[model samples]
Target: MTQTLTGSATVDEVMAALAALEDPKARAINESHGDDHGVNLGKLRAVAKQLKTQQELSRELWKTGDTAARLVALLICRPKAFESAELDAMLREARVPKVHDWFVNYVVRKSPHAEELRRGWFADPDPVVASAGWALTSERVTKNPEGLDLPGLLDTIEAEMKDAPDRLQWAMNNCLAQIGITHHELRARAIGIGERLEVLKDYPTPPNCTSPFAPIWITEIVRRQQEA
Candidate 1:
């Protein structure tokens, strides 16, 4: 469903539009998943589509303390307009994995400070920050690995992956898999570290699907790349 909205919206106007678009089905699913914020308006992308300048809308949406609103804010916000400090504050305020993931993938990844934040956050004591950092690293390697210190990254994963937080470990595992898939020179080392860590070795996978166990994941991805 779409709302008939135009012009710049104040936070209150956006909230009202969100309420008008509320989807009971979506709200139920979000609640079942333990979403902290109440009602969900389902796809607000159309609304965001109408608003050209997202910075002001993003600021206003975030202040409302609603999950859907914040998601819309991520969709609309201009990554370049945000300062590193502002992004840091947003990350700190992000209370759930989904929020953090979107903020990192959508906002941080597009920002000029991506490289700096990825390195800094990977070492942060806060697991969330560290997880985002590793995730950013995975994204970076997938797109470009020109200046990355492959040896150092592998060493870090080998040394600390076993003791890392769940989210961070997942990112580390992904990074290792990415290394094996994208960097032929480092493939063997990445596979070795994955085997040593035994990352997601026995996790369940959908039928006919290879497990995300790093070795298997890396092997399958590499095979596909070669075939293509």
Candidate 2:
């Protein structure tokens, strides 16, 4: 990798600086996210310390960086600079759920084309894209849910959630939980679906942590939000 660096350096030059900060222990943690090519350059805070002004460089890094670098790239990327087509292409290149999640939370949600991309991806044949669509919707409901179609979203969870792809099921379930917590009108239906689907019911959680099954998850979040 090229070693030269400057505040105004191009993406390639900044990537080289990032590569020099790689940490094997951090890389191991990143690999557990399921990307065979995962690499960790240390904390995102540290990366930000170094490349604080390289938001525009993220486009190149998104295309070329390894896992850690890509995570940094997502943090630095200017959402408005990306087109829906570019976001779609990035989704196609994502190989694991973690990467997909970052793209959805960090890039897609902030993009000018967010609404269009969400609608298009919800209907996509690709499981990852569809999962991202649901994830984006869930985030919206949790934050600013002004215009979202709550009834239709619940209908989708009721209809197709059970058979969704492995990665997609989690996001679909998240939507269920979000609706239950945020939309008092749909809480009962959401609880019913959660009880029936039993998503992650048997899965382990950290001690004292509530289960992500919609009923329990929704109850916990609502209580927490109310307390806040």
Candidate 3:
């Protein structure tokens, strides 16, 4: 049986509760086990509403020593919650990698501020930041038609491709394939990128060829491009 946490706990209190658990699996289970731990969309809205006012607190929260605190801070500091100054501060100060996925989902995917965040990541030396930037560009291509600055985004991807770590290349290709399926204009582009990937010749075959993200997707993209 799982224990129910009252939703009344403050964010700091919830972080403390999460930190108290010594077992990693148990902590994960507890954090995700109920609506209480679920992202509070209303809280997100409130944070978005206070973007200007809460900028400093958000940065401080992100810099906290506690991992859970930092995670929660990243959640609250969605792309919508950031202005130019705040975002620059976050790019410089936030050190935790655990929030990268959260940033991808909440801040970069559908937010208006993705461009600035992407620029920050592109300029950063950290592989994690670069990888996150590549993922964000892919996500923008797939999810947002008008939201994506296509030429600039594609240029960034192409530039990064030259020196992208193998993991980043794989992720970028996966995103490109997703964009190809969603956007007709990108289908030809995806095929070109896929063919270029194949020429790498040294690239390892990813496990599970039949998965949606496998080389099968690349082949399909190439076939569709030829058909067009």
What are the RMSDs of all candidates, in order? 2.4, 2.8, 7.6
- Sort by lDDT, best first: what order? 1, 2, 3
**Would you list the C-alpha lDDT of every candidate in the order shown?**
0.81, 0.77, 0.54
Candidate 1 residue-wise lDDT, 13-130, digit = tens: 7777777777677767777765644454345777667665578879888877687788778888899998888888888888666677788988998999888888788788988788
Top candidate, metric TM-score: 1
Clashes of each: 0, 0, 0
Q: Which stretches of candidate 3 lie over 4 Å from their true place?
A: 1-12, 25-60, 76-79, 92-97, 108-112, 123-125, 145-163, 185-189, 195-214, 218-228
Clashing pairs in 2: none
Q: Worst 10-residue stretch by lDDT in candidate 1?
A: 34-43
Q: What TM-score would each prediction reach against the true structure?
A: 0.87, 0.85, 0.57
Residue pairs clashing, model 1: none
Q: Which stretches of candidate 2 lie over 4 Å from their true place?
A: 1-5, 10-13, 37-44, 144-147, 226-228
Q: Which whole-number lDDT from 0 to 100 does residue 151 have in model 3?
A: 55
Which regions in candidate 1 have their CA more than 4 angstroms from the true location? Answer: 21-25, 31-34, 37-42, 208-210
